[model samples]
Target: MSIDFLKKYFFGDVQSSSDVSSVAFQQSALRILLALTLCIFLVSEVHFLFTAGDYSFLAINSVYLAALIGLLYLSRRYEKATAILFLFTLVTASILLLTLSNEFHAEKYALISLYSLPLITRLLFTFKASIVAMVANLYPFYLITNNSWMGSAEFLDSANLLTSADALAGASIAPSFYFQMLTFVTLNIGLPLAVSRIIQTLESHAIKMKDLNQKLNSHYAMYEEFFENTGTPSLLCDQRGKVLKANQLCRHLLTGGIKKSLAHSNITDWLTPAGENSRFAWQSDMAECTLKSDSQTHINIRRASLTEHGHLVIHLENTTELKAIQQELESTQETNSRLAHFDVLTRLPNHRHFCQQVNQRLAEHDKHVTGAMFIIRISQFKLLNKQYGKDNANKVILSFAKTLTHKLSDQAVVGRLRGVKFSCFIPLSQTYLIQKNLSELIKSILPKQITVEGNKLNMEYQVGIAYYHTDGKNAEALLERCEMALEYSNSVERFSFYNNNLENKLIEEHTLGLSLSSAIKNKHITIWLQPQVNASGDICSFEALARWQHNGQYIPPPQFISIAENLGLLPLLAENLVRALVETLTDWQKEHIHTPIAFNLAGQELMNDGFFAFLMALVTDKPWLKDRLELEITETSPVMTHPLVHKRLRSLSQYGYSIAIDDFGTGQASLGQLVDIPANILKIDRRFVFPLPHDQRHVDIVKSTIQLAKSLDMKVIAEGIETKEQATLLIAMGCNTLQGYYYGKPSPMTDWTSHSNAKAKTLRMVY
Candidate 1:
């Protein structure tokens, strides 16, 4: 190690100094290079001093140069070595300076500045290494100064020994070199340290700005996505009311792929013309507008201005669906209103609306001359619908309206007030002409068959003309008198004008109709019993005939029945009859009247889905009632019009209720239907009885009907039996049950049961 160090330090050619410290090496190298350069400049200037033979300065300079070259070589190796090698280099440098007293004294005063290298080591290396370097640099100064080796003559003379006398004698370094050194310390060391801190601060700010830019981009991307995918159209505008951005929906609505950056188009164009003064204008600061487009679809536009971004956001929402829903709701409300005030099928004002219109007309009654009004009704409309169908019946009504329209003037108005019924208004000037025209028109129109669903319908219209005030201007009273006139027309088979005498007749009819409820409740609607004798002339059952009596006048069942069904009072009549028969049977059952009681079922009652169950429940818990209770439904009942009746009747039969088909030969039932129904008994119609015992066509039909019933396992009974001759003829022809005045005139339960005629007595007339 010493040999290499001597060669490296003395010869300035160290090749294997491996363990040198980087800071120590750099510090020593810098000092040595600075010393050598100064010596070179001094030697060049003082060649004459060398001629005077003062060679000590030359020797000292050579030593310093050698030390500097060794320091440079050590510095190269020391930067790669550990702190210990740097410490050794520091100690070795200190020892070398100690041996050369003159060279040490020349640099010994610089030891204080060199001590700062140890402070650099503490900043750049470990504390122990710094302390070692600090002591190594400072101890030489302490030794040279305290031991009196640092005096001016000896110390400066040692540094001067390497310089020629001629270089020192006349040449000068000038005072600026020291000043330049001071300026170099300030510019290089101080400025570079300050610059490094500034660069670090700028780099940290760059990193923060980069992170903030990333967050802003992320938020902007999210906002773009939300606006584009939302259902409503969205637009963003700048402060000048120019569109800056628009979402996909807004593009489709307003620009049609034109970029939102367009200047001319904006939210103002989307506003309805009617809403030009709307708040969509920036000056108005209004944010919303609702209007209809050219396509009649409704749209709602909403806007919000952003003061910070200096832009406005517009949202367009189509409200067409909401408007459609509102229209549908309004239509439903209108239908309910119509139902409350008008008839459903006719589309004409109902009784309710008619009364209101009449009252209104009465309020303005003094404004015009009195006019005559006509309440016209087609008397056979129900029978027509029953024979044909409702489709034909509706055509008949429409035909009547057409005829009345053609006959009356434009000033006159006709309205359908009830089913198969119409009312007409006319001025008194043309009353006679209107009445004559209406009469002739009805005569011409009523006879023609109306074709409906490929079926011909025959019907007749009955007109009841009532002059205003004379027939009572009040709606109810006038309607009553008009009905009386219609009743007269139907009886006479012609148009009937209301006269003073018809009021009494109308009073009588009203009295009869009003007493009907009481009569039904009291069982005064007589259950006239008629015996049905079997083929062997044995009584099998008795049919109950409903007869009405008002003020001692007997009214037929057919006359009251049609009215009862129309008034919605058929159910009450049915309930009363069922109760009366059940009450009568309670006594008869005690007397051992173990016979089936057959009653005629109304067409209206059979059509009702609830009527059968109601009757069944009324007879519930009376199991004895089942065998004797027979439901006689006519073939003319509107069963074919509503097919569900058969299913409902089949359900009743499944529960052990017996149902019978009455008037089989005269009705509209087809031959195919006669076999498929659930009835247990088939009654020969009264029309068959009308041509019986003589008419071959009637006999053939009756024979076929009987065969048809027998094939279906249904018992056949002949109705309208009058004479013993007809009975004997029917019995001989295998007709089983007979009912008419021949067995007994339709008598009440008490009279029929108590009379001697209740027995199987022979008839007065012989067969």
Candidate 2:
């Protein structure tokens, strides 16, 4: 047996004496047999010792050795080898008991052989062996007790004498019998009890082993389950790196079948060529790869080394969505860039991008034939803008750009340079063929009316062509020449080319904007008051006009008005004019002037809420002239933005203050708006007034406007009447009210008061 099995079997504290005793017992039994055999041999030799020749059969001792060999073999192979060994010892002890009793006439000392039975059983077997040992010891003792030696012992003890040899032998036998009883008690009772305790300990060990095995089996089952069901392509492998178990996910990931082994498949074979050498020895790295399958997918391959199992895990994260997101972001960025460089309303290249394009095109002019930049500007667009709001103005600009785009082909680069100013680049080779057609196309597109918010607006555009290498080459020079031509176009009736005279016009406008502030402060501005006549042929109000007295010359109102508006001096100028009017009207009222005096308000002034309050504060300070003071709002002023101004105007009107709509027909005013506006007087625009004498359309509009004003309890006044014929035509067209050069031109307060007093005498005579 192995040393481990031997160690388990010999778990006791035994001495060498006990071992030698066991060997002596075995030799004694063999010696007893030998003695029996010798006795038989002597009997055979002597031939006259005893008469039972059949006793020769009992002398053969080979059966004992044969049984010994058989028991030894059984002990080696039997599952309960301990019990079998104990049985063999018990049989040997029983044989000794029976042979000694029979041969020695049931001697009480024969029971001593049973003493070895308990030792043999307890050493080799468990509690079951102890029971067998008890049977062996007790059965022999019973037989010996019932033998004639026991009866003889009893009779000898009863006689209580040592006279006969039988009695003495019986007495000896009685002591021997008592000794056997003691040995039987020690072996059968005490040894069986000790063996039973040892068997309990062995049973405890067996229970503990069973519990340990159960725990091991449970843990094994749990690990088995985990390896089978783990969803992230799991693999359980042996120490040799051979796959022990593969989960469903792992099978699907690797080859879609569990029959094929993962051990022979190289991980690199499943990945794209880009990921062949991408493995990191220590940890992980991102690798973009395409799967080797029908699916066209990009994945980020990640690997983790599992050193415990000598395995590696590969996770493929599809990055197709991330790439799509990146692509969409790039597209959005490009679109935003395009919007920045191009006009949102017109969809044309804006000023900054146009300049860059021009520079790029010019840089490639080494072998070019020629190129020209035409700065196409809308002429008198400010008139359209003043008539309509910016919303309509934007629509007009869009329409103009579209027209320009249609006129020009791929060769031409067009851009919205600025407000109402567009640039067109034309190759010189095609400029000639396109020049006339381009001008005609611009005119055709411009004159057409554009409807915005149901307001049809007539607008116009002017083109100014400045050729490179002929007119100018550089961006600044070319733009300057084109702008000059645009200015020249404004002076003439139609589109015009840039000539040397264009500089003089720019110098004039520049000089005007620079000198205007000084001119207002230095009394260089002449004030003219236009009379407002009621239906009774009497002066109702007078509109104060600003005429620039420039170096002993007169600058027309249009020239200085545009300059003041552009330079942002219009508000200051308007304030000064209002203050001047208050002073002028205050003095006139002192002189018994009963006519109302009005100061013109610009659209820019109307945008300032404080401006109307300032005017009201001025009037409040001068209470005596309040009744004679009137405020004039031009139709061009953005009335929609000034709701408070309208309310204040209405309050002023309730206090007997008069309001007038100056340059009436020149702006966007409907009959509906006029009915609601706080106005007591309407001034017919000069254009309509000038054409009233000849044009029936002008006369009809004038008649309708006059009648409408009278119906609204407002007096209508016709302006710019430089001739009696125009005045007579206005008077005959049911428009008796008039204010122009024919009545008396706009003059200084001194000249105005003088002319007005003289005209009062004439009106008194006519009445």
Candidate 3:
């Protein structure tokens, strides 16, 4: 149990009683005192107890010796052990002072233990505490040495036990001995003061030096953070260009997203040979150099050395794009000069260049050699331009130029003369004239139709021929002869050679145009109704077409319409067509037949104030006309997009008139037009409908148009559906309205029965 107690007492979490600063002094004093008490004072106590026959003191000394062994520890954790040892020694000394050291009698070891209390306290505690110990010990010490305070017989006995004959020799700490011990006190106190002064100076220096080192470390840490976060492409390297540390941008610029180790990498690896050579010779503290990288990029590099033999910071600025921009400015004028000789619309040679080259060819030809000049003119081009707008007209001209160039050989001269006309000069090289055999070649070129904005147009043209050396000498004279031939072709409506009888053909055309104006005034213009059917073969509506049979000859609609536009008779034609349409629908109404009829309206007819008022007044009183009337504005109307024209159409639509875009998918038609215009029906043009179920591109166009109409809550009608297969494919693609000649051709109103078609609705607009 004692061994267990000693083990726990020395090794457990014990607390120290002394102050933190004096703990080392307290422990050292306890160790030295414990050793001496056991070696000298403890041994002397045992001898004195035996000699004085003091068995009580001997028993107490035996227990103290037993406790001293257990209280001692070898480890440095001796705070609690030191406190317990000091307290135990003071308790033992007190016990001896109270029991053995009295006024009458005292034991010798007890007197020695009490006198040593001052010395132990001075070593273990502060000097003030030791002075209090000495004050307390003074009374007990005096009691042991007081000779008269004890009886003479007892005093003599105590003196005889200690081998002292005189009373002064009875105690070891005598008055005379204290006086002598005081003589050496000055040396002991002076030596401790001298050593304490030296220790104070050393501790003060250590504190200041420790603070200085902490401040230096803080400044270095801030410097490192600033170096790593520098914004430029900076690097820390030796003067020889061996990289130690580089900022993030510098690493990424050199390595291009690859994570390469920093060890032994040099800036010279990415430089060109010239740049690498320049870097080796660089010596200034700061220098600017233009370095070319291996990637062929120019870099304006600026470098500065941070130290005499360590680290260089470099910044790279790219100058490749700037240099290229400077070079482009030098060549701009040459490009402009070359472009000046070509036509802007078609990029073909202009009239000036064409004439100059043709005159040169005439100069080169021998007197026997011959070449022919052919001038080609697009028919009704004025109407074509008015119907489809200038942008689409430009597309047609450009397409014509490309097709003409593709058909002819490279040596043949082809050029755009001016608006809707082109010239080609083919020279004859042999006795057989190529000009006489060139009609078949011209026929082949004519069949290659021009497609403008997805609508394919027939390339109908009239070509006038004039032979060089037979007609005139140079380009100007040959062109004049060609123009005369062109005038004859315009009147006769066929390709013509140089002729002198051009006025007779013009007289005949003039007679026919006069007959057309009389037909409009005399109400000779008539309309025929063609049925538009749905996918189920049920009739939806009828398209009203203008027809004329004058002088027992059938004039095509396109031929007469172009003549009417030139004569300014479109409004008069529109008035006649509307009257015929009402008559047809009124006759059908009396027969109990009802179906909607639509007709084309040109932009010129809609914008005429007098005609617009007449049409609106006719439908204003007849409220039932809303169910039977539908107005179809031609998609190729020249002024269809004008604000006043759109206003008129929208007013008609607001009055419950069914409106549709006629001949759609041509001439600037787009998805945006369908959304913005106030129309309910999008009629697909015949060009797209004619190629359906065969041409994949046209099929996709029809399919997408149907989907777009359905998405916008509009009905889609596809015309020119000639085959049942085409109708079935359109129905499968989500279109229900279909119309074409496969259903029916345009016929008289009396031809349709009351049961087969209940009612025919009329929507007439003059085109």
Please give the CA lDDT of all the candidate structures. Answer: 0.63, 0.64, 0.68
* Best candidate according to lDDT: 3
Q: What is the lDDT of residue 212 in candidate 2?
A: 78
Indicate the residue-level lDDT of 96 in model 3. 65
Q: Deviation in angstroms for 67 in model 1?
A: 21
Query: In terms of TM-score, which candidate is strongest?
Result: 2
The parts of candidate 1 lying over 4 Å away from their true place are: 1-222, 226-234, 250-255, 258-303, 306-311, 314-368, 372-406, 414-423, 429-459, 462-767
Range of the 10 consecutive residues with the lowest summed lDDT in candidate 2: 11-20
lDDT of 1 at 433: 45
- Tell me the number of clashing residue pairs for each predicted model: 17, 0, 10
Candidate 1: 10-residue stretch with minimal lDDT? 758-767
Better of 1 and 3 by TM-score: 1
Point out the higher-scoring one by lDDT: 1 or 3.
Answer: 3
- Candidate 1 per-residue lDDT, tens place, 30-109, comes to 44443454465357336635566436545654555565455445554464343334334444444444545345453442
